[model samples]
Target: MMATAVVLDPAVTMRTPEWLFLSTGIRAVDHAVEDICSVTGNVFSEGASMQALRLLSRGLLGAKARPEDPAPRLDCLTGAWMSMVGSQSGVEKGASHGIGHALGGTAGMPHGYTSCVMLPVVLRYNQPVNAAQQAMVSEALGQPGTPAADLVAGLVAELGLPGRLRDCGVKREQLDMIAEAAMHDRWIPTNPRPLDLAGVRALLEEAW
Candidate 1:
């Protein structure tokens, strides 16, 4: 019998990337985590998000940026919830992640690369949720007044990332499974709106 081997890299290997992320400020990380949690029903809150960002920024941005003033404990919980909402919106709007995930394994791409590619599409898909948020997103991207989806689409294009799952090597037969997996994921619960398998399938199909 042949045995498969598992290997783990030392913790030090992660130090650099972690530091880099911290350097970028915790608010960014909070955004990433919250986006993941929001759509997926993951545990997160905006206040907690602020706390983590504060702690991380203290090191990266400076001690002055640290969260010296503490928020109420419940604020952390609310932040956590907000984080989930943010994460869900990220995934739901573009459907680009599905492509990125498929491409990651097939093309040896990194997680950030995929996310950069897909964020716009997800924002576009969820445009109906709220125009204010969409407008804010556009402003953040430096393309104010642009529709959120279009703004993101432009960003994705500028990044030179693949826009389709088929281009990334996903098969038609796999769509059903991927859609099912996404809908049932823990993050699904945190999504601003409930998503069904069919909705997930449609997103996948659109991406393809």
Candidate 2:
């Protein structure tokens, strides 16, 4: 059962380390983006997800520039919360999340860092299946007409986060194992773009 109440105290997290804070912010972005792109998402969830992205982008950049400030921390927390609105309503994520879970189990990659490296790649991989939904993601990130994958990749670069599997120290050989494990993730079957083991391995190769 879920808790009766939850409180958000951004002040308590105001001092979160920059690396953890930013990568997790990307994780929040991943949540919002995937929900917006999910095949089952509705107008309501997409709306919340869109707003979450806007808030996260501002808050992340704001906190990066001024870690001593509390206001941006509030924005980040609120954005993260807003990002999860879909989870409660039954919107499922896609390959980005599925693959991320495997990368975590196999390479011990931080959850947030996995999003940093995989989100953009997965976005590109799924773009063909959901180009219209993906465009909405770009608009939410305040980058109209820019491919969502490129915009997200740019954001990762802006945060000084690694965007490739190799940069995260998953040796070239590990991609195959990660793919094998990712095939079983609950999120895998729901990915907007259908995927097989070969497809999953291809994505890992491209991300590498």
What TM-scores do the predictions have? 0.51, 0.97
The ten-residue window of minimal lDDT in model 2 covers: 1-10
Give me the runs in candidate 2 sitting further than 4 Å from their true place. Answer: none
RMSD of 1: 10.9
lDDT of 2 at 35: 99
Clashing pairs in 2: none
Task: In angstroms, give how far residue 88 of model 1 lies from its true place.
Answer: 16
Identify the runs in model 1 with alpha carbons over 4 angstroms from their true place: 1-110, 113-118
